[model samples]
Target: MLALLPLVILAATPIVLLLTISTERRHALTAGLALTGLVGALLALPTAAAQAPRDVTVLLRVDASGLAYAALAIVAAACLVVIGYRYVGAREANPEEYYVLLLIATAGIVAMAFSTHFVSFYLGLEILSVSLYGLMAYFRRDRWGTEAGMKYLVLASASAAFLLFGMALIYAELGTMTFAGLVAASPEQMSNAVVLLGLAMLCASIGFKLSIVPFHYWTPDIYDGAPASVVAFASTAGKLGVFAVIVRYFLLPVGAVTSGLTTYLVVTAVASMLVGNLLALLQTNLKRLLAYSSIAHMGYIAVAFLAHGPVAAETVTFYVLGYTLASIAVFGVIAVLSTEPGRTSDLDHIADYKGLLRTRPVLGAVLIAGLLSFAGIPLTAGFLGKVYVVLAGAQDGHWFVLLALALSSVAGAWYYLRVVVAVCSTPDGESALERPSVPAAPTAVLAVLAVAVLILGTYPAPVLAVIESLHR
Candidate 1:
């Protein structure tokens, strides 16, 4: 029962908040409940970890890796909540409900971390997806939010259908929905055409959630349209939950699923790297650029698969932590620096931030650090993440993926540096941008995140140790 504390807290927080919202509406009260729940969930992780590597009713698994990943997602969500508190409160008439949706979404993410069955996986994805529908369009006045929400609704519904059908087919062929059942399958079951097609369908739906290539049409629009606070979670936590499922699902022995799955993933990874970078070069919108940047980063993370055993899971998990930290820092900057007064949307163009460095040193510095991290510059966590990914790829002789990573890194740096140069540049004639009276809480959170990026880059042993223990 102690093993379920994290999920219980995550689920219970929202229900309590829902009751509070129904009776009395208070932004501070709502955010307080949400944060308390998340922090409690974080504190409870050690309890869950104490019973590490235990299976709960064949649907959920309590283990070190799941706990760690859940912790990462919770951390990211908590950071967003801290920053988002002011943004959502100031913009919306009824801000309390926003936190409700966010907490519910966090619960869904936690569910994914613990899930060991397709039933749980699908349920968790829906919970997250349904919450996102409201979150993406939370602002009543923003047309882009409305459009983004509609597109997501239509696409998400289709993806859910794909997921269901795939699950049915896989269950039909394998006679089970659990990982252990799949692992125990005969060679004939592995090679069944129905099984491969079902796996392909599953990948198709999963690809949409991760926003990888060929299924990534919704990313830029959603990123641009959704409030920065939500975008931060959608881009990072959302992907973390889905990728956790993928890693667990694809823990197949070599040649168990044949070549098609590899071909699908590799093609999308390479495409995501090249196409994401190439398109980002043409965008002047900061959110859109970051959207493409995420696609490329996902490609780099995908290269972890070329490695065998726990190496792949560890690499992916580490990269996720690094990416989430750096991204939250960057998006936190956006929520404060780029937003117009009375606006919840953060669709600011690159040109709008002409002299961020000269004006707001703290925000400017964090922005630079985040952009550099994305570019894989030395002395930042992103650089270390890329190195581990390269080693993982090399261990399996996946030179092509490495080449793509190298090429994409160069391309990514070009654009990321362009933003950095802009931030570092002095705007002509008119004095540099005057610092607005930004909220202190968000700024403090962002500063901490920036410091964390550098700290992790310099000293990753702690995280590496955790990952090692998971596989031990």
Candidate 2:
């Protein structure tokens, strides 16, 4: 029971929130309650950590990786709550329910992060996916939002079907559905044609979440239509939870799955890097740009999977946490700047931010910092992540894929800089954006994220040491 404290706290938050909403519909009350539960869940991590490396059940395991992923997911939700506070509060819609759905989705993320069985994985994915369908279309008046939500629902359902069929096939052949049981299979069992087909289907589903090439069709529309806060969580914690599961099942023992699957992973990684970056260059909407950029970032991290042992774990975990920090700041800036209270539409287009530096210096600086991080500039969180991914790839002698990563990153830098240059450009007369009054909630979150980015970039040893200790 003690080992389940974190999950228990996280999973219970939405229920408490639902009950509270029935009594009181105040936005502050719901948001405050959500934050309380999320923070409590985060605090409970150490308690769960004390029981680390234990199987809480056949479906779940308590381990260093799970704890770290849970921490990041919880923090990501907390940050989203803060970022969305003003955005949701000013809306006429029932703002209280939004926090409830957010928490439910977060619980699902935590569940998926700790899952060991296919059943648990599917359950968590459904929970997360179902909640997001509602979130993606929360604003009923927005046609684009409704369309995006419907698209997500359809595609996500198809992916779920694929996942279930894959699980059935794998189980039929191996007589087990647990990740451990599958990975522990003999070469002969894994090499079966039926097993390979199932693995291909599974990869397709995972790629959907990671927003990689071919499976990434839904990303731009969702990012383009969803509220900034929702996009923030989906892009970071949502994808991160799935990637956590990937690292667990796929990366642990390099050759444990099959060399064929490894080649498949490598091909997708390279394709995502090249395809994602090339597409990002064509996007003029800030959120859509981020969508493509995220695909590329996932590719970079995927390369980290080439390294085995604790090094692989450390690189992925730290990179994820760091990327989350930078992402929060970037999306938080969008949340603050894009919409005025009571407004239905956001200033999401690139042209809307002309002369942003001169108009809103604080927000501009924060945006520039985040953009630089995306470009993997030195003295930023992204640099550490990029360096480690390169090192990991080099260590494993994946030099060809490493070249793809390097080239794509260079292409990524161009688009990221374009945004930076726009922000810094002076607006002559009419181009200056009106500096709307910003709220304290998102500002505080961005400030915290900014400091975290700087700290992790310049002085990573302390945090890296902690992650290393956990695995040791």
Task: Let me know the TM-score candidate 2 reaches against the reference structure.
Answer: 0.96
Colliding pairs, model 2: none
Per-residue alpha-carbon lDDT of candidate 2 for residues 1-472, written as tens digits (9 for 90 to 100): 8888988987888899899888878888889999999999999999988988889779988788788888998999998898888877665468788888888898898889888999999999999999998887887776777887898898788789889889999999999999888978888899899998888888888887778787888888888888787888888888767867876775455456567766876898899999889999998998889989998988888788777667777888888888888898898888787557657766688877778888887788888888888899999989998999999888869999999998999999999999999999986587636756787767777877887888888999999998777555
* Model 1 stretches astray by more than 4 angstroms: 250-257, 338-340, 428-435
Model 1 scores worst on lDDT over the 10 consecutive residues at: 249-258
RMSD to truth, every model: 1.7, 1.6
Candidate 1, residue 63: Cα displacement in angstroms equals 0.9
User: What residue pairs are clashing in model 1?
Assistant: none
Off by over 4 Å in 2: 250-255
Model 2, position 403: C-alpha lDDT score = 94
Task: List model 1 lDDT by residue over 316-426, tens digit each.
Answer: 877888899999999888877644467556736887677788788888899999999999999899999999999988996878878987898899999999999988888
